[model samples]
Target: MKSPAPTTNRRNGSFGHRSTPEHLGYSPTSGHNSSKVSRRNPMAATVMSVIGIFTACFTPPDTNNSKSFVDSEEFKSSSVASEASRSGSHKARGSSRGVSITLHNSIQGEPAIVKFTMEEIFQVTRNFSPSFKIGQGGFGAVYKAKLLNGTVVAVKRAKKSVNEKHLGVEFQSEVQTLSRVEHLNLVKFYGYLEQEDERIIVVEYVPNGTLREHLDCNHGSILDLASRLDIAIDVAHAITYLHMYIDRPLIHRDIKSSNILITEKLRAKVTDFGFSRQAPDIDSGMTHVSTQVKGTAGYLDPEYLRTYQLTEKSDVYSFGVLLVELVTGRRPIEPKFELKERITAKWAMQRFIEGEAISVLDPKLDQTAANSLALEKILELALQCLAPQRQNRPNMKRCAEILWTIRKHYRELSASEFRSFSTSSQRSASTKE
Candidate 1:
């Protein structure tokens, strides 16, 4: 559902809904190295958890107990970023081009955001060639570009329309928020170009596509149950880091499937910070950040929609919708379903309560004993996340822990089932002999 235009006051808590086009191409979200670092740095934990879940559930048993999961090459590469390397080369090029003045706060340890000249931007994109265009959103069109150093990046060019006042605000908001945080599961900020009518944001290119695309089978493969669980946990960790670990808490107003970028390894990286805002400071006795409501239709928190009081829990509410989406493989709103079943979360929860939760599992997934058990537990957590009141929901940190426990149980149950089948096959072979 797209809103027409801005028609309400933003300060008085009135919402003039903003509509972003459905981005079907690769999201310009991911990371490169930066001098700025996260305070409580959870990248190590994220790498360990990701390796553990995928290895135990999907790979053959690792008989070499001496090999720690973290020692694997995949995660080791994730810990070390190439953004710092790529950005340094770009800065030197910018200096030679006489655009060094455009750099924002260049320092010794912390380099400024790479300021790309309009000429360079045009050259990389071939003057905004249609063939290079990947997707479109409310802010602007996205293009895949290859930089001079051969580093692939995503370039987001703001629409030149003079009427859309919110586009500029959204662009700046995304830059400010992305620069402040760094995480394995969050997009990295590379640079920006704001010359005359051009306003562009350059971020790391996430090759795999949006979670929504994969869910819709646009990638020619269905996401298995283990992959879905890993995605949910990855997103939960990202949001939890934003809400708790950052110097100031932040709320990522948009948390839909389209905003989540999947990596080649199938891990999730939360993107689209245009609606992100710092949370209310509890030390000042403030309870919530009263602001204009901005979120997708079905994922918007009911409480925030009604009262216009945004809190950290508002994000929690949206995460709940995401959880439902992950398990059922259904969009938040399915227009073709019956009136009673149009809202996917509501319908799925009703079925869960009615003891028919198994019926709603995505047809693509083969229903097994482990899958069924995980479905019920995941839905139970989703129910809490979708609760009408924000206080009733679990915080993102708790959500991560619960998901971890769920994954552990899922792995154990799968192993037991596998062993049982193996033993049964052995008996049958003996009898035949």
Candidate 2:
């Protein structure tokens, strides 16, 4: 049996009430513990369409021909050459490889961000040694760096020539979003450095591997049902924080298991904001932000994919796929499986609706009563999140609340079963005596 998972404590009002506010387009419905979502106003759809057209017409072409980040290169400047040529002297020297600078805590009550010199970066990463390399993503390479003060941080080095156009904007967007948000379940940003031809982001180092690695058994230990539940709650809380608590609501365009970093204690922290976008303000009468689709292939929202409209519900859709992935122990896309079973979420949902919910669960997990109950409830919630229409999906807050309730019921069922077994065992002992 897997060891017990550490319980995560919720703040006084962080989880919010069981009932979501009606103003946020969520209201309790009669059956199946589902909620009603209000559709986007007609005006909002018209505005979104206009915005999409404008973006399509005005946005510059992506001239960087490399298909993937790993193969990407800094393209020669043409019409955009003016932006690169403004600084003439810095171009010839290339990378100032041996320069290092000192950074002091300049902010009150917070660690002020100062640029890490190229020399300091080289020392910590051993000149981006293969062994020091931890992971790679759409942005660039990530290395584990240990500072002189005994502080360890994850140094994310942007792909070379990231300062040119779209990639440059993405780098800045991630830095700005990371600097603004702070939450236990969200990776904390320490600082950022943008020197000539080098762009790096430093954040808190999460030691344990990603949730995907654990799910794939690359970490050599099976994650228990209780731990998975906690992870789900942790991610939901993080997304809820981004959606509602932050100064500006944000959409985590990429919320896949790979982006969810696990700590030593099995807690999850959401990372990688390269594709994150500020959500449209509902109060300001904007219904959805028009942006190009950005997310993992299997986890992208169907509505967002079709309309070029982005919203918080897009994140909710990905979360639903994640929940299914959690319980099934399968990737969102299982290409090697049988044709009908290729799409994990659809296959699992079919099993769920067909009254074989337990059949879709991960075979590694024990089929105990509590596990069965939690499985059913989680699938029910996942179905809501995977709804075809954004209006049919519940908000992130509701998802967190539902998971909280499910956890409570699971614990209660487990305790009840334990007590029953204990009493029965006592009776058997006395009779044997």
Candidate 3:
């Protein structure tokens, strides 16, 4: 018989109030347990959709283990053309043949010759000085560097030393996976340099910082309802692209707000692939190859954690938690709340069923003036995504479609309200005349 999994200390306080398998109306003996099966009911679906809409508006907390520090100095640019010439032609290198380097653009579906030297990168990033630093993550520090061509880029430099076997494996896996996949939602990799003891990846610089920064800084007030919906749609679209449009489905194990970066136009781009993995074939009944339990605390999939099996549905589960943070503007795990009451999804879902969804809305949102019914629908979607069972969560495509539908509905309602106001004003003017 397989041994029971060892328990890690539950973070974000104790597991919130347990919804007994019986209370949710499922039999524990039914192979997969009650919580897993209970999420498939139509009622649960309705609740999830409603919660999902509202939850998509809130900001996700920063759970990244890396620390971001700023540098006071500016980076000096070096001519890329000169550097390319110094490195010698790709043809020459290929003929000489050491480790053949081929550059390919995954998103554009094309290949190009790439030649960059370590010296050029160093000059661009000011030797990875603290001043140019933008952020740091579990993988490495991100520095804002300007190339000689006047192009600004974000350079990710891996941690100085990784002795742990798991961490080293994860680093190599990310480098291998991200180097090949390309999508608009994903951060673009210009190229990478692997040295004896260090690795660095060059990518496009997203100026607006992370979605979490915007949400937390403004307390969600700056993001009006429409803007919030747009962000949700953008992120959903990116995830949909990853799951369906890519040659091989990729699962972003860590799908929190921090991973979602905002461009200058406030467009959402899902970044960070350090914890991502490819999906396995469908007939194999495996979405991902079996691996160690790897993910953040609140956003981890309960099923995957228990089974030590990864899947695309794991991404869905994390997205659900993100949705909750969006709508309720609450952290996945709140230390201020009671140990058994800190889980956002469980508490919020219970309140939703009790028809007290207004209390769950972010105080920053003007729900009284907004369409309360629509918000409720979004909440329902979030609940469904957070379902304990992987099969119960909606696919990323469906989730994006649902969010798009909500956006359309809001536009129609706004148009109607404008028409009504115009008609009323015209009538009052005629009366005055």
Candidate 4:
């Protein structure tokens, strides 16, 4: 006999009502819906425990062993089975909580679906050592960790010491939202661990660090024009994925240079979903009970800040600010600036629109030829993205495509010049001979 559905309720002290798939306006595709499932079901508890045991057993005997084991079929099969079991168990639990749990496969592989145990996470992170600490944010601390198999990973451990009531809800939201999301430009979530008082998320470790760091560092040669354009395209693609590709449109309430991580190859990936939310069409103009007015102050959408109504366009505005950062290499907010001229995007765009693009290009790039026309084109795109009206901004996909096209055009122009120079040199050589 099929098990009875579990009860559904927002976790302890959850402010909003449990969101249904229908309410979110997305039909259940995975046969299970997370919104319909309860986290308190016995079967789910049992499965979680079982999976934890398996993880403990199968975890590489050492970090080196774990890396080797990850490539083996045994690891893949175990991970798949564990994930399927977790989803099934979650569905059974959901019946009790009145929430639906939907299971979906990630394109990168099913490994992202597997859930880790708190014990395993702690073991992997070496007890969140100070030496391993990579960065800290409003919600948690990021640690650089190496699993038994030698694969480096970034572990985001929620601040458990903070009141559990707040952390619990955020933890659930992040796990449910990030588990199924898979895109090349977005950061990959390997798995998560939820214990009584602690929660942790494992993601791919990006070695190149944050965009903010590169901008601040003395590394002048690192962020050349090509590199800047490439990062912009990648970040735009990631935003596009959240805005359009997902069934429920997500608003990355916070989008800043610090949130954009880069890899060794300089590929950019957007990270930190702690403040992200699925924009509900029904509550188009209403304010929800979010924990706080959360967002990096400089990147926050003025309209959103005023109306308390979050939307995908909020992200667009923030992205526009990022574009300005890339072009001018200026901080979003500078106390040194006059109070009225603090926000950089509006300031830079206004200057560019007035045909003063040369004045706004970062002084670091002063030696480089200033293409007023090309800068104007990029500024125009930024203006559209930063439009005060939500309807006026281009979506992320279009934004990325446009930036890519600009880069391609610039490359072609340079290539043609190079070819012309080579041909001229060959002709001169022949005449001399």
Candidate 5:
């Protein structure tokens, strides 16, 4: 859900609820390079547990492994950025000519997304050509373009109507949050362009569209049981990192399918940090930090919605809704369903509590092929995540461990099923010949 206009400073307890479009895109609401330096981060135990679970059997290569994807060549070429941001003779209609600036690595100690000049960005996008627009959201329109260095990127340009101060906040909020964290499961920030009436952020062009698109029928996509389980574990790891690994816990206020982008390799990357806020400092010993409510309606935690206070657990609650999506492949709010079943999470939880949760599996997944035990365990995990009391919920760390176990079960089952099918096919071919 889009946040309303500013009523109060976010730093304090006060928050403005006035409805206004935020840089954050819409859905029901919803970073990797930083990963390599800290290979032995505290979350290693959970990672190892996951690796052990699935790798114990015939391990399929992590083809979607974001760990191996990001190299120096995958980012902006040093050769192009070395020339610096020099303004050319031509300028865009709205802004001033580009002023050259040397691009430096982020002070956060990681390679930064390449900084671009207004002129260069405009040239790459053909002066914001309508045909090039890929998507529009609360933040602004996203355009796909290729830089002079041949790097494909998505540019999120702020809306013209948003005030300068608010736009500046949106820009800085994204850069500040994304720069501090990186993992294969998060979207990579490329660079940004901030100039007169223009606040644009350039990020890695995630080519596979979004999780929402695949779930929606219009896209003609149907993910099998194994693919869904893989995505669930991938997202859980990202949230685990955000809550436990980062210097300060971050509350990702929005956590819905639309904000979750899928890569060509089918790796899930979380994006849209407009409403993100830092959790209470470690020394405070506070269980929760009070803030204004800002999240999509269906996915928002009931507790966080009722109380302005936010916590790491709020993300767990939202992730529960995500799990429901993975399990049932249904929207958070299914208005077309019967009145009693309108809310996807409520319906799923009811079925799960009644020991019939498996009935809700995606019909496209071939129910006969699904592993009952894994489904039940993941459903139980979802229920625990959706607990009304935030404390009752497993933190993202525990959630990741549970999902890892489920993924291991499902992966082994899928691989065995594939082998059996292959054998059957070979036998049939020989008989026909």
Candidate 6:
């Protein structure tokens, strides 16, 4: 367990409710307790594609620290040349040598992106020193590095875990998706490297680790209610942006807490795009796109699982599970339970329906006196998200608004306590004087 937060921002809300909300009920559902997790019912494995966090082995050259990032004329010329040369090479090279290619997109406001060479990346990463490594996922490991011009960055090297046919496609998907959208809650992409048989992507380095680190791992902070509330709102806003803020919608096939990175101030940044896709145009009469389902377990939309049809609602359904994760702070799959009782969303929903919403909350936030209304609202939202039918779920926009409202209400309650504390402290100081 982590130490408690300092007094200044310590959580404050008087404990337990006068009574549990009248509508809150306790009912249990049967699924995924002792059995395999299914989005709906288990399907033919081939029809429901599944992939885990990807990683593959790579050989990185030792030690090069003299690579300039900001003012490298060589980067511009070399990258452009590499781009020109890359047009014809489709066969897998025995191994890729890192190359920084520059290409001009000169389309009005669109800024050009440059690729970094493997040597240049290695130099910055001190030859991929283990000490500098910050994270690892299905795709690869991430290292923290500083360029010659003194710019700090995160370099993600991909593992060759992808199929030969889809090896380069993942990288392309991320680049295309990230470049096309911009929002405070989304991670910023800097550049990419595909050389020396190593695929790498560079993005702005978020200081704090993932929300998963804070929640399940108990990383740096206690992740109090206020912070969690803020995170919930932040992520909802991000998903809303992805769903409607762009000319063409993008579905972030994965939206688990692990994928949400916390910034220095604990702001949420949604990262990773290996499985994102363009939304089908409804105006064209396509209600849902039938694509292979790709997402982490526990967070995949059940409707998508059963029907093989994907929609924005699938994302909403996943977000519902995320809401439950936020409310309960439990892993989606709990091996501790009999497999059938193991799916956390199902378990949490059972607890919520049983009028134990407060009991199901993280012990860290479980108060004996404060009313459970705040949590009840959140539970209601989570259930709405997890509604069996996709149409029953609220759109991301409404979800964001509701979350923001809940977060604001939570902050208001905290503010009252903060004000009272300040007044009492000032009175004591003056009395001492």
TM-score of each: 0.76, 0.77, 0.72, 0.68, 0.72, 0.71
| Model 1 Cα shift for residue 102 (angstroms) | 5.2
> For candidate 6, lDDT tens digit of each residue in 1-433?
1111211212123211232222313221221121223312332121112111101001111225321111100000000001122222322211132333455343443334456777788788899999988766666687888766565678887767636446466667777676566676777665777665788887767667778778865564578767887888878877877777566677888888778888768778888887787776776677898876567666767667555578988888778878878878887777798854567777666655555667778776756222254666676677667766676677777777677667666666667767887999999999999
At residue 228, what lDDT does model 6 achieve? 81
Candidate 5 at residue 354, lDDT? 52
Model 5, residue 71: distance off in Å is 35
| Regions more than 4 Å wrong, model 3 | 1-115, 162-164, 218-221, 283-288, 338-341, 368-370, 421-433
Question: Model 6: which ten-residue window has the lowest total lDDT?
Answer: 72-81
Candidate numbers, best lDDT first, in rank order: 2, 1, 5, 6, 3, 4
Q: What is the lDDT of residue 229 in candidate 5?
A: 76
Residues 123-163, candidate 2: write the lDDT tens digits: 87789898977777657788887776666778888887624
Q: Alpha-carbon error at 240 in model 3, in Å?
A: 1.9
- As for candidate 2, its clashing pairs are none
lDDT of 1 by residue, 178-197 (tens): 76667778876667887777
> Model 4: per-residue lDDT, tens digit, 200-299?
7777676666787777664445476667778898888778767655545567677788778766666677776766676544334433323234466556
Report RMSD (Å) for each prediction in the order shown. 16.6, 12.2, 12.2, 18.4, 15.3, 15.8
Q: For model 3, how does the per-residue alpha-carbon lDDT over 222-303 read when each residue is reduced to its tens digit?
A: 6556766777877787776666555455677778777777765666777667667766656445456676556666777766
Name the top lDDT candidate: 2
For each candidate, the alpha-carbon lDDT, in order, equals 0.69, 0.70, 0.61, 0.58, 0.63, 0.62
Deviation in Å, model 6, residue 400 alpha carbon: 0.6
Assess candidate 4 and give its TM-score to the true structure. Answer: 0.68
lDDT of 3 at 288: 60
